[model samples]
Target chain A: MTGSAVSATALIWVDGERASALPLPDRGLDFGDGLFETLLLRAGVPQFQHLHLDRLAAGLQRLAFPDCLDRVRNCLQQAAGELQDYPWSALRLTVTRGSAPRGYAAPADARPRVVITAAPLHQDRCQPGAPVALDWAQLHWSSQPLLAGIKHLNRLEQVLVANQLADLPADELVVLDAQGHVCSVSAGNLFMLERGQLLTPALETCGIAGTRRRLVLEQLAPAISIPVAETHISPAQLTAADEVFVCNSIRGLQPVTSLGPRQWHDHSVCRALHEEYVGAMSC
Target chain B: MTGSAVSATALIWVDGERASALPLPDRGLDFGDGLFETLLLRAGVPQFQHLHLDRLAAGLQRLAFPDCLDRVRNCLQQAAGELQDYPWSALRLTVTRGSAPRGYAAPADARPRVVITAAPLHQDRCQPGAPVALDWAQLHWSSQPLLAGIKHLNRLEQVLVANQLADLPADELVVLDAQGHVCSVSAGNLFMLERGQLLTPALETCGIAGTRRRLVLEQLAPAISIPVAETHISPAQLTAADEVFVCNSIRGLQPVTSLGPRQWHDHSVCRALHEEYVGAMSC
Candidate 1:
């Protein structure tokens, strides 16, 4: 996720035309006034396309971007089809409030710009047994209940958290809200297995409501007969869980083998969820 | 700030050259992983250049953006020089973590991108005795202490707040934090004259640390003998103040004449501060 490894022709589109550059005054670059979605492409088709598009549409509504959901959905489908040569890939969809004259206030007639980028995806990252090590992020997430659950472009906190882990011997960083309740891992939503119930932190105050986490809660868990709940999770509760895992659209489900001194090798629950998610993706 | 009103040729620079577009993979557009400053250009020179650059430098350090402050400053000066025809103008300087492959994680070797845009400024917005009506913003600022003060590019909250005021008669919107404490106005830092002391909300948890607000606390108040303090301010305290005003680099200082029902016509304090700020900016 951190390299320039895309040697193949990465598919890119700006407002329906194939372009690789954006205007200097684009509001997305100016104020991060936009929303984005990252989807995993399996056999040239985006897995969980409906969930990703739905979240993007919701984000556009929240940001008051123009009603162009159908155009965006079509762009995503068309882009994915064009990049179908790769068996597996990653697709990113971004909808910005378009370019604007210098300012924080978005113009009333601003047309939303859509930018899509597709790259090859590595399948090994999602393998269940290949758990990732984690550490507490040195930085804390800001408590903006107004922005807690949506995947907007204002992600400086994530960038800061990820930067701190650059020198640490960890694959992921567990971030906390201003009040210090467990919010999320650096790049995904967190879920803990405790007393036979699947629990993820409530995103009312922080963290992105990841698409894979939604699938687990709304579909996969029920299909697999695992009880799920969303609630405030303290650091102590997270460490004390029998097993812990994180999920995002790109990386389906990865077990946390270690977080600082705490470690969990029993990833049976994570494996089951990953298998279910993968099976569902294929259909 | 919302309209496309520049009739003169606006100057733009990207990475030190005259350019009007950026590579689509820029992380600033992708994740809003950057900082920006909008400065007022008076007589072909950027006013408060030192303060604005210092703030941008501090933001870069906090966001872990690559250290390129000197280059950014030089670019600002160079770009502003190219657009010197307008006696009054606005210059926006942006520093992003450059472009990266699709992901939240920063590429270790990422080069920083610097973009500067210069446009004509309207003189009427800064008239000394012009008092503006205000209303409380329905949208609250998210509490992220880590990003509370710096002028980062993640400004969707400001966009949302301003959008709500589009149809309202008020000239500006007073925003509060998630905890209901007075935070700031929709676009600038707020100051209140209470009991002979000029009080501004502490930005420890939210709001941008505006450059003009900084100038007031650091220079104008001290030179004018008006005591200033930064502390937790509530709505009750704001309404009870003898006078209320807002400040930013572009608009200078403006007195708020009305807030919903409470009205104040006193221009003594705001006029004094505005005079001091104007005098200081000219030198």
Candidate 2:
């Protein structure tokens, strides 16, 4: 399921072309009307390709594009073949409803477009589980039941969070919903420790269900336990936590060095689990 | 400030004819990474081109596109030239971080793309200030501040709202926020008249800051006044009001003839304005 290349950079393809143009009418670019996954590859093999594909499938399903599975797999394989010699890289898979009649009423038969693009890997940004200094952003995430958990195309919130923290001390940020519950970091799933139990938001109300977060819970060592991260994220509970970390498929587990004004010693639980399950990299 | 071709259905330029393809890497489709405006064209001119363009500029600024105003205007002109002589159609102008790399680290020098497309006139969906029927959708709007009211590409919320009302009515839809405030209809701004004073939600917090809303407040009848239509939207307000109407650039003014479990008579105020400012529709 991984690409065929094995270099330090990723090879990209858009509908099987190394580089091509999207018509102005594409829904992906026009409406953020698509879904995507960022997966890491080492030695030409993608880590968790099936899981990433699964998450992408779930998103496609939510958006009503279940037929993209074949195109997605084939595109990734072709891109991997091109990058067969790269040492490290990442794969991005995107699917969107192609040109519609300038409105959201997508007909049942509208053909969707697929975009798979890869770029050179960076030593930073995606080095796996670095301790990212983070803080609570002033911006409150809106409660969107329809779009709470799924990683659909709409991502202004992520872009905004990234901007708010661009000049702040936080390399990343944790956003709260209107009721003051921890949703997740700017671009990752949040996990915290209270009395040594792994905890994360349920993601049903909001926040993305990071494929890696599921892995940490179900596949990581010390037995797959329920997330100590509860669905009802209260500020008081987070403040009283013993440890915190963020998770995503591409970046793995990033230990939270700081949150708001509180700082914590690196949790051994996170380190060990990340090392075992996520292939955590050293900062 | 509007394009020279005020009468076209939409701006059409074939591939490479005028920056035809939105360079294969537009973030709009990439992230639903853009905002758009569909304005009403009457008598071969945009009713509020300057205001619409200003909103587009503000949205681009919000999105961190570092383009000069002149650059945006030039793109508008190009699109306008192709739109000449097509009367009474909706004109769509979309601005996106044109072509960029695969990820969210927006390029430092991202050259934004401008797409102006027009579709054939369809008056069936929008017909004057006649009281349009609406049903209260079960779906509550997403409360993400980062995505709130910017009119950015993320519209899954709206899509969900649209889908929920398929069994009911489509002349309009009354959507509640997660907190249960009457947000707006499917595609237009809502105004409830209380004691003849116009009331609308403060879109600064969420919802599109409507150009038609602006014109109604700033240009239309000077007798009308605006009250805070803030986030604490209550259904009681809709019932307590004497008149309710929806407004958008394309739809002009559509009065709410009925709501779920309730109905209202047409207001004289809405009809007067339609006759005076809105005029007769050509399509």
Error of 2 at B49 (Å): 0.7
**Residue by residue across A161-205, what tens digits does model 1's lDDT show?**
888888899999999887888989989989999999999998887
Q: Which stretches in model 1 have alpha-carbon errors above 4 Å?
A: A1-10, A124-129, B1-10, B124-126
Tens digit of per-residue lDDT, candidate 2, span B1-283: 2555433322454321454456555677767667787866643456567888888778788878776567666666555545445555666777777677665557778776667676546463334555688777777676654455666777776666655655565576777765677777778888787776677776545677788777666655453333433334488888777888888777678778777767788577676556545543333
Local error of candidate 2 at B37, Å?
Answer: 1.4
Specify the highest-TM-score model's number.
Answer: 1
In angstroms, the error of model 1 at B35 is: 0.7
DockQ of each: 0.76, 0.53
Question: Could you give candidate 1's per-residue lDDT for residues B75-122 as a string of tens digits?
Answer: 887777665666788888888899787777899888899888887866
Q: Quote each prediction's TM-score.
A: 0.94, 0.86
Segments of candidate 2 deviating more than 4 angstroms = A1-12, A122-128, A223-233, A278-283, B1-20, B122-131, B145-147, B223-233, B279-283
Clashes of 1: 1
